[model samples]
Target: MRHSIAIVSLVLFVLSMALLLTLAKQAYIPRKEVRDLAKIYLNTTYNPWNKKFTAMSPEGVTAIVWDYRGLDTVFETAVFYLAIIGSIALARGIGKYSKPTSDEKKLGLSLIVKTVTRITTVSIIAVAVSIALHGHLTPGGGFQGGATAAVAPLLILIAFSQYFLLERGVSKDLMLVIRSLGLAGIGLTAIAAYFIGVAMNKYAFVLQNQAKPLSEVSIPAYIDGQLISGTLWFFNISEFFAVMAGFTIVLILLVIPERAFKSSGGEEK
Candidate 1:
C-alpha cells in the first residue's frame, strides 16, 4: 500500500508540473489588443487634465483602490480589521497570555546581530513610511507599506526580546487602540462629504468626492505646493496604521508562552 501511494503521489506531482509548464508556455503566446473594462481603467485613471472625474493620481492601482473602487477597498479593510480582531480574541480565549517577563523570554541574538538589526530597523521603518505616504503617486500603498513596516517589529523581536519592545512602550492594548483609530479615520473620511452636504442642504452621495456634483467636501491634492492626491493619501495613511497595528498585536500574542495561558485559565472547561 505504501509503494502504491508513493507511486501515485509521484505521478500526480509530475502531471501538475507538466500542466504548469503548459500554462506558462501558453501565457507567452501573443494575442491581439482587445478593448475591455481594463482598458477603460487604464485610459482614464491617470488623466489629471480631464475634468469629469479626477483621481489626480498617476498610479493607476492607487486610483483604483482609493477612488474608482473605494467602497470595495473600505469593506476589504473592514474585513481585515475583523479578522485581526477575531484572531486576537481567539488567542486570548485559548490562552490568557500575558507578555513574558524578560527572564522568561528567550535571550536575544549576539551583539553583532543586535547591532545590525538596530541599524536596519530604523531604515526599514523609514522606507515603510515613505511607501505609505507616497502611495498616492507611486506604486506602493498603505497595505504594502504597513506589511513592510511590520518587519521592523518582527526583526526587533528577533534581535531584542519582546520585553525590550514593551519597555519601549509598545503593547498589544496600544496597538488595538491605534488600529481602531485608523479604522475610524477611514470611516469618517468616507462619510465626511455626505454629512457635510447634508448639513449644508446640498446633494451629496456617500463617499462622494470634490469631483462629484454638489459635494463641497474635498481633501487638498496639493500641500505646500506638493501634490498629495487628496483622499488617496488619507486612505493610505489610515490603512498604514491599521495594518501595522493589527500585525503587531498578532505577533505579540503569538510569542506569549503556553504556561501563561494555563495560569490564567484560558483553556475551555
Candidate 2:
C-alpha cells in the first residue's frame, strides 16, 4: 500500500511540474519576442542619424561590442587573465619539478603523434592570427584567437614531451614576454583613446558621410570611406596578448612533471 502511494505521489509531482513548465513557456515565448523586438527598435531607430550610422550598418554589432559596452568587456578580460594567472601560479607552486612518464620514455610516442602535432601547431597558429586580425569583421575576436593560438604550444608539449619542448627551445619566459607585450599594446590603446578626446558616444570615428573627425587616428573600414576607431582595435590586441600569455603560462606549468624540479635530496627543486 505504501509503495503504491509513493508511486502515485511521484506521478502527480511529475505531472504538476510538466503542466507548470508548459504554462510558463506558453507565456514566456511570446513575451520574449516582444521584449527583444522592443529593444532592437529602441537601439536602432531611437537615434536614426547617429552621426552617419544608419539602421543598415553592417558593423552595428561591432560598434556595440566595443563602444556601447566595452568597459564591461575590458574588465571581464582582465578577470579572465587574472584567474588564469592565479591558477597557473598555484599549480606551479605545487609541482615545480615533477617527472612524468612521457618525460622518462620519450621514445614510446608514435611518429603519427609527432607529425600531427607539428601540423596542428602551424595550423592553429595561422587560425589564431586570422581570427585575431579579422575579429572586427568576423565572429572570432582577440580572446578567441589568442586562446586558439595558445593551443599550438600546448600541442607541441603534449606531442614531444615537456622535457623536449623546454630543453630544445621555447622557454616559458619567452612566451610570457610575447603575452605581456600584447597586454601592453592594449593598455597603450586605451591611453590613446582617452587622449584623443572622442572616447564617448557623441562623436564617431566614421560613417556613411565622408566627413573625417579631427582626431589623428583613422583606419579605413570596408564601408566605402568608413573607418574604425583605432582605440577599439588596440584594446582587442591587448585582450589577445593577455589571453595568450595566461594560457601559455598555465600549459607550461601543468604539463611539466614535478620531479623535473626535484633536488638531489629528492625534494622539489
Candidate 3:
C-alpha cells in the first residue's frame, strides 16, 4: 500500500512538472510602456503635485493594496483572522489541565543547535521588523514580515521546547491580546481621516489615505518631514503584529501535547 501511494505521488509530481514546463513556453510578457488601469496607479502613487489621486505611497503595490483598495485587503485579512479565532475557540481548554514536567523543561536539541538558533531567531525577528516597518518603501510588507517573525517562535519550539516559550511568557492569552490590538489598529487607521474630517466638519472617505479631488481631509503623509506614506505604514505595522500573533497562536496550540487534551477530557478535535 505504501509503495502504491509513493508511485502515485511520483507520477502526479512528474505530470505536474511537465504541465508547468509546457505552460512556461506561453508565458505572457509585459509591455514596455505602462497603460490602462496600471498606468493610473503608477502615475499617481507618489505624485506630490496630484494629491487628489496620489496615495502618497511610492511603492505601487503597497499603495494599491493599502491605500487604493484597502477595503478589499481588509476583508481578506478579516477572513484569515476569523479562521484563527475559530481555531482558538475549538482548542479552548486543551492545555489548561496539563502542566509541563520537570523533564519536559530540559528537553531540546544539543547546546550548539540551541546557541545557533538563539542568534538566528534574533536575526529573523530583526529582518522581519525591517520588512514590516519599511514595507511602504520596499517590496516586503506586513503579511510577509509577520510570517517571517513567526518562524522564530517555531524555531524555539523545535530547538528548545514549547515549555521554554510558555515559561518565558509566550502564552496564547498574551498573543491573542497582541493580535486583537493589531486588528484594532488596522480598523482605527482605516477611518482616521474620516474621524479627523468629522472633527473639522469636512468630508472624507472611510479608507481615505490622502486628500481626494472633492475631500479636503487626509492622513498626514509625513511626520516631521519623514515620509510615512500616509496610512500604508500604519497598516503594515498593524498587519505585521496581527499575522505574527495569529500564526504564533496556532503554533502554540499545535505544540500542546495530545496528553494535555486527555487531561482535560477533550479530544482536541
C-alpha lDDT values of all predictions: 0.82, 0.61, 0.89
- Worst lDDT run of 10 residues, candidate 3, spans 96-105
Q: Model 1, 1-269: lDDT tens per residue?
A: 75998999999999998889788885354568755977777777766676456667878898888888989999898788888879877885553545645564357888888899999999999999999998977779999999999989989987887777988889999998999898988888788777777787877766655455445556567889888776788889999999999999999888776677677775645
Off by over 4 Å in 2: 1-20, 24-27, 30-49, 52-62, 92-108, 198-229, 261-269
- Relative to the true structure, candidate 1 reaches a TM of 0.82
Q: If both were scored by lDDT, which would come out higher, candidate 1 or candidate 3? A: 3
Candidate 2 per-residue C-alpha lDDT over 1-269 given as tens digits, one digit per residue, 9 for 90 to 100: 76998999999999998899898875344543456744664465224355333232234454455545556766776788688778766654442454454446554367888887788888888888878766655666777788898888777777777766777767778777877787777666545533443654333333212123354333323345443333444555667777887787888877655454453234533
* Most TM-score-accurate candidate: 3
Choose the strongest candidate by lDDT: 3
Q: Which residue pairs show collisions in model 2?
A: 97-258, 97-259, 97-260, 97-261, 98-257, 98-258, 98-259, 99-259, 261-269, 262-269
Prediction RMSDs, each to the true structure: 4.5, 6.6, 4.1
Residue 189's lDDT in candidate 2: 59
In terms of lDDT, the poorest run of 10 residues in model 2 is: 204-213
lDDT of 3 by residue, 1-269 (tens): 75998999999999997788678866455769876898888899989998688888778988888888899999999999989989988877764644555665368898899999999999999999999999988888999899999999999998998878988999989999999999999999998999999999998889888888889998889999989988999999999999999999999998887787787776546
Q: List the residue pairs that clash in candidate 3.
A: none
Question: What TM-score would each prediction reach against the true structure?
Answer: 0.82, 0.68, 0.86
Candidate 2 Cα deviation (angstroms), residue 52: 6.3
